[model samples]
Target: EEPYVAVVYSDYLHLVCSSCFHEDAPLLIRKCKEAPLEACKGCHEVYYCGSACQQNDWKIHEAECKFLSTAVAVPSDIVRMIARLLIRRKRGDHDTFRAYNGRKFDDLMDHRSDFENMGANFDKVFNDTKNYVSIDYMVDREEIVRYVGKLLVNQFAIRGPVDTCIGNGLYIGICIFDHSCQPDLTRRSIGSKMILRSQNREQTLNKNLTVSYISPLACTEERRKLLRSNPFFFHCKCRKCEDTEQDGYARSIKCESCEGGICLVKDDSAPLRCMKCGITSSITHEEANKWNADVAIVEYFGSEDCALFIRKSMHIFSPPNMRDLAKKQS
Candidate 1:
């Protein structure tokens, strides 16, 4: 799906193409490398791969060209995207685009109550955006704030090589898909567009397509907490979220009786039961908690290497556990 608006992060303005969102030399495709990126002469804050890219991006960049030149520093990624949306609205371009379900920008959820509660945090971002956008585009402050809320919640992170986030983009059509902890659809970012692919084409053909807004590797509690958090405020009752058995398996411990088998402890008062062999496990919940704590330490404050993290966590987390899957994927 094509993005309504896309912007490179301020830190990557020089390294990434602002128009196509391509890296200077994309990994594994050295032959596709283009001439060195050139900063826009008008603003000098945005870069393009070539004249064609610069010309293509000029339509949206033109609105903020002079203003960006005047600013002490470039606005934040979200602010730049908001400015582009406002400029598009000012140019009567908002109505030109429609979502997969024919929803327009005004039809999208703004979650006004949540943003209002944000108070100073939201105000500060809006105020910063105002400095870069023209007065004509700022005629409707309330409407702008609404767009702020809409974009914050709807924007998709544009990922590059090795799933590194290069920037943010808004694809209204793709936003129509609901969030699921175990998603039916997976998204891949190519240039400025997003492609949603089905995990199981045959099974998902007639099913409602869902995507994981947060990492699919996240545990049920972590997934629900993130889904219900700010910018994406909604309690997820997805199949994965409602499955208690799945949650138990995720927190299971290595079995003491059986080789390579895992045991599940129903509660603190109960004995751990091996899933592979029906044997009662001698392992206690305290041991499981300690293993979890060790993984957390290495994950947050210890090693930065994903391979090392995964190696350290393998024996601790059971194979079927979400944390185990998360580490392996990382």
Candidate 2:
């Protein structure tokens, strides 16, 4: 059960339960002990799980319903979310919220400065969010800006079983997790809640917990660029970003040298290597044979030596000026 739950407009909410966020909300709601969902007459677009859910959600949705019942350009998703949060705060389930983020909401990371660093186009986006607030919500523009930044950096997209995006939600408790190019945690949303389990949930405790914010299928540079743009304004320095070999195999191909081996970014400068055979189509036989001599030594070497040797091999096999190997394969 969530301390709080919020849903988008009914058109977007669709068959999903507005209160609990269940996909089969309408069908399951029919089996409820309570009366059926109350559809708002104003728009015939809003529905609630029950009377209590209707009243609770109505506290915020009323204004939206009335406004939406009429013709107006629908607000951006972020603007609508900010509006909902403002009204929900007034309903005031203070104690329930205190358990997370110390309930300040202010304690949430501020991406305002991050946007400032990005320059004026970001400022325009922030300004556009503010423009949506003026007549509908009597809110402080600065407060809206802060919440907008928080939502951008913190909200998690609610995905269906097939990885289709169902909606988006914000959970203060789970937002504290730092991201990695290769995540240790996998996110699964059940209705309104975001659950993080160990990528290997069988074992618990501390084992380098992490989660990927972007697809690891992209090569290192692509992931870094995506993370540094818009919402996430920082370049990733994760191990995978530093070493291209960590690229996920979804984008990889079968190696010519060893048909069984996956050809992946083994050299940061250019060549793709056969993971099992340690052979590269781009690396000449003479060079590969020489490099292969160090494999046993690399295996026995300390972590620091292994890293250095790998870098040396990359420089030797694919000079820095050469084009990226993954792009060529793509």
Candidate with the greatest TM-score versus the true structure: 1
Compute the lDDT of residue 318 as modeled in candidate 1.
72
Q: Report, for all candidates in order, the number of backbone clashes.
A: 0, 0
Candidate 1 colliding pairs: none
> What are the per-residue Cα lDDT tens digits for candidate 2 across 119-176?
6244454555455444645456577677778887877777543344666777666666
> What TM-score, computed on C-alpha atoms, does each candidate reach?
0.78, 0.65
- Candidate 1 worst ten-residue window by lDDT: 294-303
Local distance difference test values of all predictions, in order: 0.73, 0.57
Q: What TM-score, to 2 decimals, does candidate 1 have?
A: 0.78
The root-mean-square deviation over C-alpha atoms between each candidate and the true structure, in angstroms, is 6.0, 11.6
For model 1, the superposed segments whose C-alpha errors exceed 4 Å read 26-33, 118-121, 203-207, 248-257, 263-330
Mind giving the per-residue lDDT tens digits that candidate 1 earns over 54-154? 88888888877877988888888778888888878877777876766676776678888986675525676778877877677774567767888888888
